[model samples]
Target: MTPRTGGRKLCGADELVFYDITASFEERTIFTDILKKTAERVFIPLTVGGGINTLDDFARVLACGADITEDSADKRSLAGIFLSYQAPVEVPGVPLYSYLRTITQKRPELKMTARKFRARVGEIAEQLDMDSSFITRELNVGFSGGEKKKIEMLQLLLLQPKLAILDETDSGLDVDALSVVSRGIEAYRASCDGALLIITHNTRILERLSVDHTHVMVRGRLVAEGPGSLIDDIDAHGFEQFEVAAQAAGA
Candidate 1:
């Protein structure tokens, strides 16, 4: 197979680099090697897509140093799990309400029309103390930190996923917004009997919910484990002891 040609006389580095593949199944492995080399050289936001079929494909491409993995929607969407990101990306052209509708529609089990779904979203937005006009705005485009987190909470509540993974939802949020986000989380738990896996350093959000387990991780290693009280201890004393233990173990 012949490799495609492209060129740019770069004085320094480009702001962003995109690598897209249209290789046949037979040529997938070849592009994987190419991607590895490109990742090694490119120091910008590199988004790679095409011919990725499974989770393993994503893992492989990411391991190759691709910054973002672009795969099919269904492949990335784990059926009963909802993940609220710490930093939500903005999609300028997509309306918040439409995006939510499309995602919910992907789950055949979720039976609701676009109109009804819009109303449902508005109700959740109100609960988050967000304006109804936000639904008409572009997804995360110019929203404040609190608004973005609230939008995530809105999605979590609307989806009613069996498991919600919240990644630092409290980060950058003020006290009121934190309370609103926490309430949305609790509503999901109460209504769906859903489980939560909250990843955060702030105990403020946890103070509102009933935490069953706590694990202190340092340098990607779990150094301590305890009940919910561990949160209070960490809040009062800080992670100094845990960090010291992790360092000792590594040494």
Candidate 2:
């Protein structure tokens, strides 16, 4: 499990580091001790994969101080979201339409312009049953928790990251609000071929999602993985079984 550090001397005291697991499963142990030592020293950006079949493997990887979490969603705004949908490869200091025209010559499938971008975002807002004006509001000012989540969904629709990691987006919503959020999520799913990683403690949101896989995390590690039906099972049986399984896995 020799780390391909890309020539970055990890032994040096640095505030940040990125570690990706690339080898087969049996070699994971070679990394555990190094990560534990490094974690005691600095923050590590980690990705663990390869031959990790069970949730227990996820738990062990994270347990080796590879766990990481983030909350950058609050800093992103609705206007910013819309702006991200604009063509990024466009020529600098040129009108969006001009850059769009240039892009169209190569990829004729794209029809982009500043006007159409706004129209599309507005159309999405309307589909989510939201006021178009709110997209330009001062972020989440004067909005309820549910509204904030709705705006996040709008961002998800427009920005469309390669992997959408929604961390408890359904936390404080009422039934109606939950339905709206669910609809927005379904819309986003339909709009792209991207991946979604929904992190949550409640199963209410699962009612509308076409979940491919479900994983339960204990502490900061995944402890179970199953089909969408696992959501119903968890709802009925709770995390007692998962908690025990996690303990056993760690032991």
Candidate 3:
């Protein structure tokens, strides 16, 4: 999750940037439609990308109510959106401390009472058996992949959105880290009134996080949706079976 401008502000008010570098055109269209609907209801800015290449594509996206920013060489002009950013996650000489300060302030809601923040941070650090200072610093920078995921889960705990989306957030965690991450996710579910959409290929992480729904994607389409048990089946048999099933249906 990208850190918000301040700790207290809720998400969705600012432009939401999606890095969909490998999504298909149809998938992009569907995503744009979703963004449009979401923006209409929520009244927030939406920015989308990944595999975009034509002026008409930009026009279509903008017509749907998005502010476009394109990093690709393809030049396009759309009324609702403006395109920029040539590379993903590029910070050109942006001061890390300044950036962190901005995020901390912009999402002020995320900043709990200093006592609460410190207590929760301490508890999480203790649970992970790390130093409190280490956790604080890690939350800002120099975090490993697992640590970043854990911090992100912590952020979710703090923010408690109506819906949370985890896009392959478990890809590189070790067993212990995965365990910690799962516990944080579970804690969020137990404490918050929110639903989670976790996009992960690994089933082990699901052991702790009770998934209300599971979805399988193939060729940028939702090929299957089922209970958490689907994760078990996928773990045992792998997605090859699902791919075959999808192919058979297409045939």
Candidate 4:
């Protein structure tokens, strides 16, 4: 595939790095069917990553039939999960009653009496068999790291993407949060036939989520790619092995 920047072909197919930075950030959730539709329109291999916090993210990308796996590992996992669900800011000078009336008109199903609201939240919580009070909370804002991860997992349950590239979903999470996130990923894997590319440095998270492939990056290059067991080898021996190989290649 040829990509022209200012009428110049900077690289050919073999040298090209098919990166999809925009798709990752702009499309917070990648839908598999949507991606498949997109893939039908394109011929070249696609590499995509952004805002991917769960297995569903991977499913969407893979459904597109992309070959290379790409991702950004610098994600604010907990904060992002909560902020994604925050209520919209009230317009200046608009009364709360006006806002409520507008929302009720637009979404009649959510128009609830005081008692109805409480009962509905209670019933939905009961149906899920989870804590009711937690369901009524304002949003995921100001939540702990663990709480944030749980929220992300909840979003994943709702999305169910095909091929996911989790860009640092394990970062900043405590042991329990890590376990919860891992279990959520495992659950997703169990329920679907999708692939996962977990980009993380934490082995704790890996303990629960099975890894089929592992790739190492150094100085913006994928220096090594191998099976899931490569993670254990790297943890035990560090990147020294790859570094030596690189030095030899340079020599």
Q: Which of the numbered candidates is closest to the native, going by highest TM-score?
A: 1
| Residue 95 C-alpha lDDT in model 2 | 39
Model 2 weakest 10-residue run by lDDT: 78-87
Q: What CA RMSD would candidate 4 show?
A: 11.2
Model 4 lDDT, full chain set: 0.53
Lowest summed lDDT window (length 10), candidate 1:
1-10
lDDT of 2 at 45: 56
**Model 1, global lDDT:** 0.76
Instruction: Give each model's clash number.
Output: 0, 0, 25, 9
Relative to the true structure, candidate 4 reaches a TM of: 0.53
Better of 1 and 3 by TM-score: 1
Give the alpha carbon lDDT tens digit for every residue of 1-251 in model 2.
22326423456433344445444477653356666766565544544434344434444455565533431332222112122211112123543333323433332233466577678767778888887667455555566777767766776676654457777777777888789889978987888766778877888888888899988889998677889989999988999999998888889
Clashing pairs in 2: none
lDDT, candidate 3, 72-142, per-residue tens: 32232122111211111424454433344444444434555656656765665565544555542423355
CA displacement after TM-score superposition, residue 178 of candidate 2 (Å): 1.0
For all candidates in order, the CA lDDT equals 0.76, 0.61, 0.59, 0.53
Clashing pairs in 4: 24-50, 56-161, 58-163, 58-164, 59-161, 59-162, 59-163, 59-164, 60-162
Write the candidate numbers in order of decreasing lDDT: 1, 2, 3, 4
Top lDDT model: 1
Cα TM-score per model: 0.69, 0.57, 0.56, 0.53
Q: Please, what are the lDDT tens digits per residue for candidate 1 over residues 1-251?
A: 12223422344554434445646787554267876877666555456645555555655665566644244445445335578989899999999977988888866667688788877888888887899899899999999888899899888888787567899989999888898989988888778866789999878898888888998999888799989889989999999989998888889
